[model samples]
Target: MNKSLSRLESALLLVAPLLMLLGGVLLVRYDDQGWDGVLAAMAAHPARSDVGWLLVAAGAALTVPPTAALAALVRARRPGLGATALVLTALGWASVPAYAMGGIVMEAMAHAPDRAAQVAVLEQFNDGRGNAFFLAAALGAVGYIVLAVGLARDRVAPAAAAVLIGLGGAGTLLVMAGPIRALLLVAVVLLLAGQAWTVTAGRRTAPASAVAAV
Candidate 1:
């Protein structure tokens, strides 16, 4: 069989969505209150907070294998949507490091000597450099939507899964804070479903990626 995954990648793909889902749960658990809450959580439960960040980021980055497989699957049938999704998602992953940096900055904010210092740092970061991350995030969201639609249109995944993925993609694009950010958990669930669909249903469409069905 023409396999896209070499066991290790397949395993990682299987675990990636779950890890990210778990991370989202943890993130919402602690940083649901926005920047204020994130910094607070950093001080209140540093380990859990950091772990959540790592899980979410790592899971997202690790999704490469499955994403590649999905891209390959859809690309063969719906080249336009598939290519757009692949590019946008790759761009979206760019936010990973930016997100990690944001977490680090939040930790610094938590430890900052005073409010003034925190504000100063926040201002500096937000000046321009930080604003650029929004583009990456937005692009990533667009990519998810495109991929979801592509897969569904190509019959690689169900329409229900596509809807979930589209909704999740929209959620990721929103600027949420407080308990509202908990919506991210929904996105994670959709992500898992979408990824799972790729592993199972999508595999049927392409013979070469049987091993990478996830």
Candidate 2:
């Protein structure tokens, strides 16, 4: 039953992040069109009264399930890693509130249409109390490192399966180190790939030696 649950969880981890990535792509592709206009018009429809919010919310929602699964797996197998996952999840989830504030600020700007106020709100929404977001980034980095350690220990997934997970975490960490936001894109890609591999591979085949060790 535990193994079965792990496989299901693995599938979610792979699939959910991929969906989020796709949603992000949609937003980016449409930004020049309705997205930018919507941001500008937020003050006009402060409560997300338009369709644009749909895309953003959908994309954000995709990130949640996989993140939760990752946390669950980490908690089961590695306590320290679980704590790291929690921190990362906390930051990732915080984006919603920050974004909601951004929406409202945009709405206010629409009402008054002040460039200075718009900029201030935008900046605040981007960084305010969002140290959690940054901490999440760092924690994701830590997660990859911890996963690598687990891989080495052959505790959870097979060692062969650890590459992308490790890479995803490392990419996340790289983004946290400085102006490597580009690395974040790469990290997302790695996460999707890694999760996909795990899902398809199913549970690890515990070797005879591993069984004896356990």
Candidate 3:
């Protein structure tokens, strides 16, 4: 069972990055319009908007497996920090599907005849008072940093992996620039590479005790 589980995790870790990358590409491709122009843009490019949202939703859902796998690996080495990082990152990822739902709303707005109504819907989507959004952002930022540090200190993963995770955490800030938001994809790619390395290397070097614990 243990070996089987490890193999499953490794597979997930490998696939997660690819999904994230594809999703990011779709998002960037469809995001020609800024948030302010989302309705008009969706109306103009309905197919792109639909496909992008679907990809985003699928990619976001795929992230869960790798997140859990990484957390489990880190937990084997540093329990407390690993658990905290896992929770935070999980919460952050959970919010991604909500964005997909918002995309649905955008699609609806695209068809609405009243421009004023479309703007109101967009505003609500933008300015919603849900704490989940803030929680995901704040926790994810801190979680990735802490997870990177823990992974480095425990030597469970390569130093490069830690660096990539750290940079990914920082890349969140680039979202404000819209076009530069591709930084998120870059970050995900780095993370995917790092985690893949960790799984392969960790399995080879990990002591029997460590493997059992993991």
The model with the greatest lDDT is: 1
Error of 1 at 10 (Å): 5.4
Write model 1 residue lDDT over 166-196, tens digit each, in one string. 6665455433222454576666666666555
How many residue pairs clash in all the candidates, one count each?
Answer: 3, 3, 0
Segments in model 1 whose C-alpha atoms lie over 4 Å from true places? 1-13, 28-37, 173-179, 206-214
Tally clashes: model 2: 3
Cα lDDT of model 3 by residue, 1-214, tens digit: 1232367766766676666566666552324245446666667777666676666667656666766666666777677888988887777666666666666667776777888766765556555754456557667667778778876776656678777765664353223113454676777677676766666664333543766888
Better of 1 and 2 by lDDT: 1
Between the candidate structures 2 and 3, which one is better when assessed by lDDT?
3
Per-residue lDDT, model 1, residue 51, is 76
Give the clashing pairs for model 3. none
lDDT of 1 at 58: 83
List the global CA lDDT of all models: 0.64, 0.51, 0.62
- Cα RMSD to the true fold for all candidates: 4.9, 6.2, 4.1
In candidate 1, what residue range of length 10 has the lowest lDDT sum? 172-181
Better model by lDDT: candidate 1 vs candidate 3: 1
Candidate 3's C-alpha runs over 4 A off are 1-5, 28-36, 169-179, 200-214
Residue 58 of model 3, lDDT score: 70
